[model samples]
Target chain A: MLYFTAMSDDNTLYEDLLRIRRFEEAVLDNFPKGVFFGTTHTYLGQEANAVGVLDDIHSGDIVFSNHRGHGHFLAYGGDIRSLFAELMGKTTGVCGGRGGSQHLQWQNFYSNGVQGGIIPIATGMALAEKRKYSDAIVIAFMGDGTLGEGVVYEALNMASLWQAPILFVLENNRIAQTTPIEMAVAGDISARFKAFNIMVRELDSSDVKEILPVAAELIAEVRSLKSPRTLILNTYRFGPHSKGDDIRDKHEIDQLRVERDPILIHAHRLDSNHKEAIELKVEKYIQEAFNQALADPLPDASKALTGSINHQ
Target chain B: MPTVLYALNAALQNALASDERVVIMGEDILDPYGGAFKVTRGLSDSFPDRVITTPISEAGIVGIAAGMALRGLLPVVEIMFGDFITLIADQVINHAAKFRWMYNDQVRVPIVIRTPMGGRRGYGPTHSQTMEKFFIGVPGLRVLAPNTFSDPGDLLSKAIFEDNDPVLFIENKLLYLNTIHDSNRLSEFEFFEQTPEPNFYHHSKHNGTIADLSNNYAPTCMLSLRDAPPPVLTIAAYGYISEFAYQAALNLAYEYEVFTELVYPTQLSPCDMGAILSSTKRTGRLLVVEEGTHNLGWGAEVIAQTAENLGSRLLSARRIAALNLPIPASGPLEEAVLPGIEHIIQAAQKMV
Candidate 1:
């Protein structure tokens, strides 16, 4: 079922996973210095979910990401400097600094801060491409917390009934802010998608090698069949939810970090020298992006406040 | 002889036939049912590929339509009842409306959400309510309502094809059966038309003063009675309530010998205040009528805006709106709560 088996031979996937890990670390480290504005959800431990799924995205494929979307944006080949500038609220940032870390729109990729809101939008975009008879598909990323929103089920019903060309990647980190998944979600997650007749694939791994092959198969099947599919990635989050707000036990978090770190799990597959080279390059790249973003000028307050009131 | 419903249907037909990218998505909007209010009649049969009958999910329907709009398609969503707009407020306010500006003009959501608002049919509290007051001041949203006073089809078409923002097209439930009032029919009241430019016409009764401003979008109408002294008060109303306001103006003139100028606006938000201001300035008095409840409603916003601008020149101003209570299901109770032609006439008579 895996179509792009040759992709496993290259070190690009290793670099992609490292890039997200390092970039998020920089965001958390500098957030105390007041370099970024508003709130940000770091994609600390979910690097494989983004790098594995988005590695072989088609040219016209669209990606709809959620609040914790820095990893998805980076894996989509988004410009690192502009993304950093967006977090810094600079005029040269993506979306002109209007959409901060949670809300970003660049090229064919879009992300919103609201949970479960992007599901229907992504389904509709997939339907649009299907109606046009275009070979394009859509990828929508959702979190476990979004399961509480009623609109998610509403969209899933239509996505299956309409047979939209979409791949719904559910990154269930098993915690919603401060509440654990056991306290929130009842029954099973895969059964929710299966009830709508959408085919579901469940994987509980952090290694990019295990995730990439399954994502390639599901993504290819969605394009060829022009129907909706779900990929439930049971993942983990290493950092606090956002800006130091973790209530989980320190020992449990540290234990999971040692066992399920996506970068560390994938690094063992590469040669020692090659892995060190990738790590050094990614560290330098993250630093330069952050420095350039810090130097950029903030948006003009006087002019930025003008256009929204005049709705002509 | 086209009814308001026929005109709205024609607008949808024309837009779907003219552009291949125009899509119609809603519940029960197919050929047999043709939507809850029948505004989308015959559209599904005509454009089979474009017309989509969706599930009974108001929020999901709007979100899907917004996605279609973001990807360069003109999607017109029909929310069966206007009261259900509460479900889709997040999608319209946070997502679709803010997409263009939030994205810094990188994309635009050209969507038209047509819903049947207002209550005269006794559809009860939940089904029969005018809810535009909740969305009047929304920044990136255009709230448009068409009546028999002008061509509803033309206004609907403008929202679908011309505007590049998200539009909430309000169609009053009672107005669907009413026939359009042709401009030439105003001759019965000694009315004369003045076309300052093509597609822009101003009609005024004999001896009534009119504003000189030009509106590029739908223009507001100023209705006054013939053979009466200059208006002592100006009445501002919109949607289905405008019809009753005009009737009250006529009754106030002939029955009570009280003259009042009536101003009806189709565009609720970004309202063209020039016409209302001109009439109010001449009269020195204003009365705003609304079908929705009075407290913090559209009428209050209008009165606030006009008062802020007019200051001391506006000698007196009042609002005639529904009682501050839920619209009862009983016919008599609903009538007792809602404002009607009798209420308007009484208000105008006392104001004068």
Candidate 2:
């Protein structure tokens, strides 16, 4: 268990959280209307994980994301219109729309590819950072499915051995696609990293107040210690794994939704004025973001063959 | 004639003198003993800092080279044997070759890996195996296999200076004693080596080409330059198998009507298809051979591709090659499994 110190915000944190919520809602609305193809795993229930982690990381700090990566990229100030364009394979998109729906990239920081494969690369980047003496932290975002890959262990071993300044954020959504936590995970998740002797923090990912401060402390500890750290953020999907697998059955989705609604819980914790203000601000931002993405031109003809934003 | 050891020593000496940026990294490339094979003899004494002995981790050596190349250093990493190179395959393929493309042309990995590949001195499966095919599959890699002694110097210099990619220069153990001369046959590598501080090395006119065997261009004729070659059909080969192929070619030419044109491919990966094509086209018949098992062996691939393209020209193109078995520790067994001179003679007789 971890605790968050009492601190005040300029309402920007609340606004950021609202922005994520509204953006997903807009995506859900537009997706079914044939404007978007493929699946999108919305982070409607896992807003705190994004806000909590991204707040501690600087602009120069690199982050690795997974299939459920829109919120992660968005949290790190990724250009919304460019990202949207990239998903649509438009020249205006971030990766020149080369990395469609599943793949996403922004500059040197890449959150494109399967979860586990990129973990070792993040370790390599951390190695490069240490060698170049750059003050860059590598954050590898993964889901429960990624834990099974041998790469995770290999990267973790190297990172811990090197005392690399890397943070492994495992968003334990209690389900990997349709598989439940019990069916998927064999050993205790925290115990898995204990052999590597890395610092671990298991906490309710719903509470931004709880998650933000601990992340700051852990990140600081890693920087100061020049060591790697892991934090198992127990989050929920709120929606299905993606748009294609929406798990639309009310009885099934509602049961999972009720107990694991991070945003609703956060709202319940805050005042009515705060919640309404956040919702209103977030709705406005989402509207603006959607309009901006919509107005952005489709990718130029040459960009169709381009496969990735980073490559282009 | 100067041996492969002499050529290697001269190659390193000249390369180091020409390029200040070129540095040699390996287990023992220094003065106390230049190397097990003495390829870098007297290198450490001449260029002390340039020849560095690394910890016994092939991966570390190559990885550091990759890093150094990124920092604008042309590092020549000697893995000693091709077998040990697999340990550093990740560093070589993933980091060095792909970094430039993956980083969108922001970085470059200019490094060269030199090692003696195949085996004949009873090193067995682990030490003797040839796996150039594994790496040939990888993109963004430039491989140079020097069949004769002379090209090692030239190809190595080019590999060191060439920017934006890594080069794999594989040397055959048998070719260490083999000799070559300049294109005009005026200056020999052996004589060039004997002469102190000689920079210009002549390319062998024969160039492992069968066409040159019968050509009126006596300057480029196989007989002009007296280098160590099998008597009958100097079957050009690379790695440790060169000795077998050369000897076998000679045996076949004497025992049978088939005249063997031994053309050793110095560069295996990014194979000099033109040179190979010319050799096969002239010879009309070839007995491709290697120490590696024949199921998709490097030599068989060359034979297959040649036979496919030059269907009409090919004269019984077959590989008197090794079977699908690891190199046995027993000397006789190893020889039995390996295609020998007798096998070469039989294949050549059938072809003729």
Candidate 3:
């Protein structure tokens, strides 16, 4: 069993949250400048969900994320430079630039653009770990939009039926792209999971400190029982679904940003001097990642067809 | 006694018993239920821990199989019907087929997708259809179908252990109950006087004069002749339609005096172009037959490659396949849509 030790001066939690927030902000800033090639679903306001949940992820454990997966990738220790390189379509990227932002795959970390596709894949990975008698669990991260897909339910049923060691983290921001959750989802999400006999734990994503203890407990339960569980993080996305889709009202978005800003809330916990030092360090790190990734050369078009198909 | 269905069961049983990493997952594959087609009967009872009964989720099954394969397990997934393959096409085409190459050859998806295809059961458009054409050109996938000459047991075992790539093992519904008999077996010619001198042309590279004489199941042609004469036309077919091609060859040998050779290729995707080119060079005319619809079908691919390779040496080439339309529920309508032995004979005659 793992326990969270929050010392009075410990800044790891705050730094993790700040790194994702700052990195995504850097990506958004570079988007309009045409530095990054394709669209990226920013994990702007949902940093606590990824940081808090992935705090307990073991080294051997695997993680699968959705389209809005930059934060999950970073929180799980994905290389920031390679991630920026991937967004820029460089050969030094995680997937050698073939897979863009939505399709980032590194060691023990994978993300796909398709909704509900990774749940079953994560469950299978958990099944493999279980069969091998390894204690490593799998964490599959999805948003409220993924609940609309039928494959998620199928995966949930299998995960529960097989008692796979998987922690399904649902970052329920109550919105699916431009559409609100009320317009899309039907009934109680937790009740639906309970019907499948999976244990459900709801966590408030407004504060990383509050999310850490609960996430650690749930992770321990999944690891001990080797059973499927869910941690529904009630959060909100501060930015648009993508770069060019700011359909939400500015007044409402500003209110949520002020009331539930994860970064500010965590920063308030730190001393003034400590917060300043951490922010400066995180900013410099993000800047270096951006500059290094920009300096990297683009992939050669002549060798584009090399790894398209593998033969025996 | 070794029917196609039993041969499949034997192959699956051998895989499960041989490797601890081998696992079977599908809907209704558990014991008592066996499977939709009973190909997995008694498997669960014998290897209870390995054979997993899954929900009716094609995409989930395939996606999970891909994950398992990536994590060092040889997973054999059974998609109950061929038509349902469309449900898992994204996982098959995008994920399973692309994972090895897209991931820079770091992983091997040693997975076998076993599904029953073809339309003769009057099961209607959605259920009964030969949709193997859709998966033919997929780069990383090996699409194969078993015929009379090839044993499903051996083919499936090879797919499981020998190859590191994913294989789409298509089993025809009609051939499930059919017995596996080699026409050239000694028991087949027991009544003949002096063993009825073997009268056929074997490729110099291949030593087998008859299908039964071969020790291994490789892609090869079996020529049926009235006398020791060169074939005028080479009729190539696979899966269920190969039975029709064999019948047409025999009929042409007896009636038209058009000595014909029948080519049955077990592996269809990376088809054995060497043997096919050799046979087509000897017999300048070629007729390709398949149960899939004619428009851009497997037959089209065979003809295209043969024409490109043979060039002027190939005299004429034609293809006989199902009409480009949905299979109907009525027996006669299904028959009308599908290509039969008469269609094969007519197409061969035109080429001759």
Q: By TM-score, who's the top model here? A: 1
Per residue, candidate 3 scores C-alpha lDDT tens digits across B32-74 of 9999999999999999999999988998888888878777788
The segments of candidate 1 whose C-alpha lies over 4 angstroms from its true place after superposition are A5-10, A308-312, B188-216
- lDDT of model 3, residue A102: 85
Classified by CAPRI criteria, candidate 1 counts as acceptable
lDDT of 2 at B176: 69
Query: Which of the CAPRI classes, incorrect, acceptable, medium or high, describes model 2?
Result: incorrect
Model 1: per-residue lDDT, tens digit, B32-140?
8888889898998999989999889999999999998888788999999999999999999889988877887777787999999987788899998889988878877
Order of candidate numbers by DockQ, starting with the best: 1, 3, 2
Q: Which 10-residue window of candidate 3 chain B scores lowest in summed lDDT? A: B188-197
Q: Write the per-residue lDDT of candidate 3 for residues A51-99, one digit (tens) a residue.
A: 8888877788888888999999999998899999999988788887877
The better-scoring model by TM-score among 1 and 3 is: 1
After superposition of all CA atoms, the RMSD between model 1 and the true structure is: 5.1
User: How far is B183's C-alpha from truth in model 3 (Å)?
Assistant: 7.6
DockQ of 1: 0.42
Error of 1 at A8 (Å): 6.4
Q: Which window of ten consecutive residues has the lowest lDDT sum in model 2 chain B? A: B211-220
